[model samples]
Target: MTDTITEFDSILEALHQAIEKSDSAAAIRTLQQADHDQTAKLIDRLSVEDRQALFGLLTPEQGAEVLERVYYFQGADIIEELSAQVAAPFVAELDSDDRADLMNELDQADSEAILEELDEDLAHETRRFMAYPDGTAGAIMYSEFVSFQADMTVEEILNDIQTNRKKYIEFGVQYAYVLGREHQLLGVLPVRNLLFASRSQQASEIMIPKPTTVHADDTIEQLEDIFEEHNYLGLPVINKDGCLIGIIDRESTTEALQEAATEDLLKFQGLMGKEELRSMPLKVRSGRRLSWLSINVVLNLISASVIAMHQDTLEAVIALAVFLPIISDMSGCSGNQAVAVSMRELSLELISPKEFRRVFFKESSVGLINGACLGLLIGSLAWLWKGNAMLGLVVGTALALNTTVAVCVGGLVPLALKACRQDPALASGPILTTVTDMCGFMLILGLASLCLPYLV
Candidate 1:
């Protein structure tokens, strides 16, 4: 370990001392001395057996503070490891939103035990969150937030905050929402804004207008887009009736999005992600990967069949056979170039109907130019090696033509797929390779057959 590691270890040692001494105030003070990651490490270093003991040393409220400071998964791990009977009361003590997230990761028996331990209203709210799809805003949002009538004066809101500050702090309230008498969302006010507002101002006067709101059903992808666009720390969630339901903070969104994106990326590459693979046995992981590999094998076989069809032509002109790989390779490169550009454009939404024709023409031009240059270079090599000018010319011409065709096909196919509501990126690798292989084989061999007499 280096200086940083040594420092962190010392901090952990200090924390352990505090824990052993049953100094709750000292532990909280120790937390202030270290950074967030250091605090997380201290929490993680304590075994599951030590969690309740550690908590028992602190007040219920101080335990809540420590729990909030640790990583969510680390807290969940401790909760899961505790006997359900022992853990239930602990779970009941968590803020509603944190409880929901922790419960979701627990075994069914433990989850049910915790639910039974919760007050009726908290249990119902926690169940509502668990019912949402895992990757949606609803599932990630915290039910605990500050809300007050829009008509209320700032002084009134201040009084309410003073009354509920301790409860809100324990609940992890980051921002307060403004709602109508019927609980319809009107706007949002960050705690800073609330603290700075004039006492005489109405909540509506101080609250931000038309604040970004998320529907309960919005996907993690949609939430990511919104967060990226607005650079938000948090956003509110509402039901169909426009009633405030919950608020999704940056932490939850970040966690959910990282998992969701990893899953999507792994799926695109034909693999199960770390998220899905983490809990799985090695045998199961292998089985999942093997299925995708089998599909790739089928694709390769199709390319092989195309090669098998031209065996006779290959045999007659061994020189041509030697150069076939060059043709296919050139075409494949050109196709991949087109696929990459198209995918990037589509993903960024840079490709539009108005620009479609321009993009197609540009890619086709690029294909033709690249194909001709590569063809000239390869044809020259074939002529020098084989001592047959016609053979070289045929290979060169075929390469040039096929490259152009491959690129055009590569660009067009993905765009067409996108227009038809399919993902364009999916059209790039395997499908593009297949098209390039077939075209290259047919073009080179077909040219070879036509030029056979001249070579002989």
Candidate 2:
């Protein structure tokens, strides 16, 4: 056999032997080095006769951890590879979130089969989440949480916890929700409060009513803001009928924040939404990127058209052409700075109509100060290089004007977009660069044309 095949086969053999010997550490090491095929081979080897049988040999936690490691598709393959009897405990071993995620990934037939194998309650909850559009808070929340009747005494709840101390692992309750007789959510009491409360105290007395909640349909961004605002470890997700369906915990919130941040970053660069990029093939990625690139090329052509109008002046005074880059550079840099600041403010919801006057003044002041310093530097450099004081003066004036324009465009455009219900970060990248270039080129060259007679 060739060296590559020999190495691969040897690794597979070693991995199989390790698993057969119940050598967890050795199996882990082998898996760490295995390619997709080899990794699948290991799972397939253990699951050859009956996939669910593999779960019987591993602890629930270990099985859950291993399932997470495999690609979602591979996990599904393993599930199908197992018989119905074996798949039951394996599915039960997964936490609510993981189970929901897996169910959503499975085909309807497989999902129904698996659901039938699960406990009735767990099966129903998983199906509930699978019903939500992917990425919404409902799809991501955990159905397991601590809930107490409104009239339950603190002592009663404490006694229950003592009786069912092991239940916490399965329910994964970080905080307890207070509910009325019909299971309508009334308030929330943190774990800390419950522990500190008098045994005689009722849950209703200690719980905070009107606790923050998000509807199941709330977007991830909305959920993120609620979490940040409330300083919550998790927030309850309720249906329109005011029924508590699930809870969005801190872990899910963090994941949502990461995905939201990624989307914003991609949108800032004018890319398609994150979902498009995540599941798309390389060729699809290229096609989407090329489409945007072509649009930007048209914008660039507009900028070039503006520059071409001033070419006669540029040729007559080659020094002006040399000075052009300096002005454009300053404007683009200053505009980008303003755009970044504006986006930060917008993201934090720190800006509003009431703050508009102050924000504009602040941005304008920054622009003026930036323009003055950059204008002086570029003007002095041009004078020294071309040995023409008049050329320097004209270039400096144009630099200052262009810089001011660039800063204003950067700030105002984002604000305008926000006012029209558009994302401000979308105002960055090619759009910002193109605007600054067109404005800078016009200001500098137009001034140079007017000042050419005086200078030469």
Candidate 3:
């Protein structure tokens, strides 16, 4: 392991030097020694100047390979810096799936400029997949899988695949899709079946009938469920009229799931919208971040208003101030847990928006037990700190009720937003934070005000 790490470090050092010097031949030589993934990581570590230099030095084929393997947003940043003529060849060299993914990440003007430079057929193919909305089956599927007519013999199909071995491998040709006269999916013929069956037999005679397929507009969540439920190697993507358009292999499904997960994680932390990279323009990055923070400022004021309303009660009992953050922070943590669960279930399609009652039942039961324990813990601390029973009771009761409300709100809010077609991941956090703060303040203050004489 030490020797391997040392070798990689040396390669990294050498690559950096070559790139810094703008020596194309030396950089290319260093790149040849490192694999695509290693080169991608190295590229990410370079300064913007060096990155552009290295990118320009790579051949279009090498550029396509790195772009296909690197993070999609980073690839977009690299392409965004290059001219249309310079980026076009690399975009064209990518597989149909990768071409669409890269184009989807780029700015509209840049994508259009690059698209114009591609050959007619390749450009049309890229546009066909790109036309689908993001996260749909059409967006993730490859256009290169092999297909044959029902009347074709096994020998004919085998001959074609053999004649075009490079294309078959490039397109991920595993099972030969059987199609009707109109390109409607009829069935699938496994490669093994084709190899073993009599060469003279027609494809329809040996194919597996009515293979599983997804519509072009279907969700990635649905694709994930089907992939898990069926454990199939690939699924056919069809249009509304049941005509097969392309094939989504297991790799594509897995990649889509990962991208969705990363996307949701970013949104959970208020980084909603397009994925951001450090290499992006300062104005654009700061602008995207502030868009959410600006809304957060408003939501925060609303939470703060609750405290302003109960200022008199707070002044009479200053000790209560110490526990304000404890209750809110603890409740926020509980609410976030509920949010995580709901987001997970939503991604898995395990729960629906209308099934609020089921989620409520589960979250509330957890809330009750957890709330009671948390209340007792904080209440004991309050009594310990002030040696007062009333202080303990007020804070404890407020915490208990606040926790219960927080979990319920957290659990149900995502469902409500999702049902209304809002982004549950992006909207859930601010809503949960504001609710936990306001409710924690209201419950603590309201209870303390009623018992202010004893608390003092």
Candidate 4:
């Protein structure tokens, strides 16, 4: 096809025709003709089979370009589908951090096989990067940066940068760092200084001594705070021995945050192992979904048992049945809002698990206000429909009380779960739902039973 891929949708038919014909040349030509953004979107939307088919047609250089642009996990999936032999060359073209990311996401067998196929130095470096605990600065830091010994003359460093233009360009010259023999960071030389400094001066003589550094094992939260406070484009990362190893840039930290957010959203949806995709194995998709659905059945049954316990009150006042779900659902919505706020605060480190009293008081104040407002509205509705003041009061009071209970449970349960080191997102929704249902049922039915004489 001579047609250029301007829009992703326009290119799909050509790709399908090429794939169906099993023409690798046509497939690749079609891919090459497509716009870069369209190609990436096309890749993302393809089924696993189509993705593999299309990727298989790409040259190693082309494949590497594809791998680096897609999200890391998404790239890992592509690598996992390819043969270790076919994947390693493309992997070799990636920078150290990106290489480590793809390798880390591979299955053990796949990773080992791919590693074996890679250059010895590259393989070893990949393993070293993988050894960093996930969510630490080391795990996501860029291994590309320009560094020189403190003794190198400005002329010599400038000459070296010019000679290895491609290498330095990839390294992203922000500020040149000076290191000791052991590679301990000694100083930083702002790139602009080279314009004014004497060419004969040694790096240490002109460099700003003892520039800021972060340890490789530092947490991402620490990195976020550092970057936010300083507004620096990048910071040098060192090992426990204080030798420079990598660079932690604003881009890396922001990407880590985005990945964490995606993982949390999945966890909140009850996806086990914190990830799931339709393209994943059918068994994996089924099992992850069933895990939550199965527990939900048990929870729903428990709420039903509460209804069974109050069978007499429900029978006596048939109108109460209409409001049971309304109350539970409305309160559950309020409670989930509290849960969301608590989760956000915890993630931002604004609050800790031990601050139960603080969360309780804040949630209770809102709950009382919202509950009273909601109660009045529902109370008015009940009175108009049923033409009875006592019935309206009973229904309205139950909803109001249940709303308060719901908000408290929603806000507190997340903190309690955090204290126990459990996932608040996974447990909070079900906990809030079940508690609100049982409480709403008890309040309405229990109050109605007490005031039975007046109603009759």
Distance (Å) between predicted and true CA of 144, model 3? 1.1
Worst 10 residues of 4 by lDDT: 1-10
Whole-model alpha-carbon lDDT for candidate 3:
0.88
lDDT of 1 by residue, 353-394 (tens): 346677779888998899889989999998999888998899
Compose the digit string of candidate 4's lDDT tens values, residues 1-456: 334534555677788888778788878777776666666666766888888877677777777877877767778888888898988898988888888888888899999999999989888888999889877889998777888899999899989999999878877778888999998989888988866899999998999987889988787888898888997999889878878899888998988988887887877777876366565678878988898989989988998898898898788888888998999999999999999999988877789999999999999999999999999999889999989999889988998998998998899999999999998877888888889988988898889889987665
Tens digit per residue, CA lDDT, model 3, 1-456: 999788788888998888778787887788778776776677677777777788788889877877876788888888988899999988988888888999988889999999999998888889888999877888898877889999999889889888988877877567888999999999999988998999999999999999998888888878887888887999998888888888887778788888888888899888857897776678989999999999999999998999999999999999989999999999999988998899888866799999999999999999998999999999998999899999998999899989988999999999999999999989999999999999999999999989988988
Arrange candidates, best TM-score first. Answer: 3, 4, 2, 1
Scored by lDDT, the top model is 3
What's the residue-level lDDT of 400 in candidate 2?
A: 88
**Clashing pairs for predicted structure model 2, backbone only:** 51-82
Worst 10 contiguous positions by lDDT, candidate 2: 272-281
lDDT of each: 0.77, 0.75, 0.88, 0.85
Error of 1 at 55 (Å): 15
Better of 1 and 2 by TM-score: 2
TM-score to true structure, per model: 0.65, 0.67, 0.90, 0.89
What lDDT is obtained when candidate 1 is compared to the true structure?
Answer: 0.77
Tens digit per residue, CA lDDT, model 2, 1-456: 598778878887876676677676776677668766666555645534433444545665666666766655457656656666666577778767777777666667877888898889878877777788754788788877888899999999988888888977667677889998878899999888888899899999999998888888776767777777777788898888787878888777677667557767877777753334233357857877777788888988988987899888888887777777778887888888888787767655677624666767887888888889888988888889888888888888888888888887777667777787777765566777888788888887788788879766
RMSD of every candidate to native, in Å, equals 6.5, 7.6, 2.7, 3.2
